[model samples]
Target: MKTQVCIIGGGPSGLMLSQLLHLKGIDTVVLEKRSREYVLSRIRAGVLEHGFAELMREAQCGERMDREGEIHEGFYIAHDGVLDRVDLHKYSGGSSVVVYGQTELTRDLYEARDKMNGVVIHNAEDVTPHDLTSDKPYVTYRKGDEVIRIDCDFVIGADGFHGVSRKSIPRDAITEYEKVYPFGWLGVLSRTKPVSPELIYAKHPRGFALCSLRSQVLSRYYIQVPLTDTVEDWSDDAFWAELKRRLPEEVSARLETGPSIEKSIAPLRSFVAEPMRYGNLFLAGDAAHIVPPTGARGLNSAASDIYYLYHAMVDHYINGSDEGLENYSAKALARVWKAQRFSWWMTTLLHTFPDRIPYDQKLQQTDLEYLFSSEKALGSLAENYVGLPF
Candidate 1:
């Protein structure tokens, strides 16, 4: 098979890029190592920066999102047994975030691809890119003992952190930066109604907890845990009891508890790979960078990457310009580092650091106190939370 672009991932980033490029009459093919069912089964963060929501509309995949997703103008930060709201709309100059599940968003992308009869190969094994430094690059994958090769103008590495995309690049060619936190988040997806109409981020002596909802009927919640903890270590009852202890008494009194539909423990980490381009191969999304879920920058950061790459591809193909492609790495990384800083700051501010010195804990408390006390501080937080411009 031959195409203009070969995207080595069927997640939102790769799928979104393919959809956008195809709309421009750019032929492309997508390869996924997992089945569609497996891809959609992974639970992820739901908060969408307004900019990301707009990209969905541009891709013609926002109808369901706009209809079903909730627009959150503000969220609460609970500390010292009280809840204080951060006015995202007021502080971000009227920008607000969309609360839509990644699963639903991925489904919409899949349906859109189906309508256009886009090519998305699932369960592709041993996918590899070759001749990346050359003008013509091709990707190969094994399917049922047969090797399939796709010749393309460009190869996109959106497969993910553990994916072969980044690993395919030579070690000396790419510089990696990473920081693994000492704790992880134990998240639960329950069918019960959410405790709050808006999301609540709680920081208590016990730990940090977040009360979020996919919809009014479906709730998603998380509590900070030691990295050593596992799903089997906490039953539904134990999880609920521990979560309640972290929340304020008033909020906990009205909180609804139920069996978790899904549960998983994800370790906190921040990572970025420099110069997202390796010859003709460009990286996007988790393949290039990742943030702790504290600020909801994981998928939104990928959206910015897709946005930059989409415009770059269009300029390269339709306008006969290589400027955007040439500057893609620097441009994307500029915004990426900002997100990393924000996520790191938020995580540091709220999470309990087992190894933190007493002075650091006091400083953390003071930081939260200053945030609520100062309008400028709140504005900064709101601006980052709503997302900075692309």
Candidate 2:
């Protein structure tokens, strides 16, 4: 097969880019290692930055999102037995975030692709890119013992952190930076009314707990646990008990509990790879960088990369300009590092670090105090939360 771009990974990043590029009359193909059902089953963060929502609309995939997704102007930070609010709209020049599940967003992208008869090959195996540095690059995948190859002008590595795209690059050519947190977040998805209309981020001596919602009736909650803890260690009753203990009394009093629809533990980590571009292969999303869910920057960061790549590809194909393509890495990295800092700061500020010294604890406490007291501090948080300009 021949195409203008070959995208690996049918996740949101890869699909969004394929859809966007195709709308501009560019041809592309998407390869996914997992079936569509398996991809939809994975529960992920639902918070969508303002910029991401706009991008979805630009891709003509935001109709359902705009109709069903909740727009949140503020969120609560629960500390000291009180729920303090961070006014995102007031602080970030009236900007707000949308509460839309990543799974649903991916579904929308998939449907959009299907409507246009876009090429998305699922259950592809042993997908590999060849001659990345050469003018002509191609990708191959195995399907039922038969190997099929796609010849394209460029390749996209959106498969994820463990994907073959980034790994295909020479180790010496890429610089990796990573920091693994000592704890993980055990999250539960329940079919119950959310405890709050807006999301609540709780910080207690017990640990950090978050109250989020995918919709009015589907609530997603998380609690900090040791890295060693697994799903088996926390029953529904036990998880609810620990979560209630962390929240303020009034908030917990109105909390609703039910059987968990899904449960998993995800360790906190921050990672980034230098020069997201390697010849014809451009890395986007988790294949290049990741941030802890604390600030909800993971998927939004990927959206920014797609935004840059889409315009860059357009410039190259239609306008005969290489400026956007020439500076994709440096521009994407600048915003990526800011997201890293925000995620790291939020994780440090709210999470109970078991090994933290007393001085560090005091500093954390002071940080929270200062955040609520100073409008400038709140403005900074709101700006990052709604997302910086793409």
- Quote each prediction's TM-score: 0.99, 0.99
Each candidate structure's count of clashing pairs: 0, 0
* Model 2, span 92-191: residue lDDT tens: 9999999999999999999999999999999999999999999999999999989999999999999999999999999999999999999999999999
Which pairs of residues collide in model 2? none
In terms of lDDT, which candidate is strongest? 2
Q: How far is each candidate from the true structure, as Cα RMSD in Å? A: 0.5, 0.5
Show model 2 residue runs off by greater than 4 Å: none
User: What do the candidate models score in CA lDDT, each in turn?
Assistant: 0.96, 0.97
Q: Write the per-residue lDDT of candidate 1 for residues 1-390, one digit (tens) a residue.
A: 999999999999999999999899999999999999999999999999999999999999999999999999999999999999999999989999999999999999999999999999999999999999999999999999999999999999999999999998999999999999999999999999999989999998889999999999999999999999999999999999999999989999999999999999999999999989999999999999999999999999999999999999999999999999999999999999999999999999999999889899899999999999999999999999999999
Candidate 1 ranges with C-alpha deviation above 4 Å: none
CA shift of 279, model 2, Å: 0.8
What's the true lDDT of residue 216 in model 2?
Answer: 92
Clashes of 1: 0
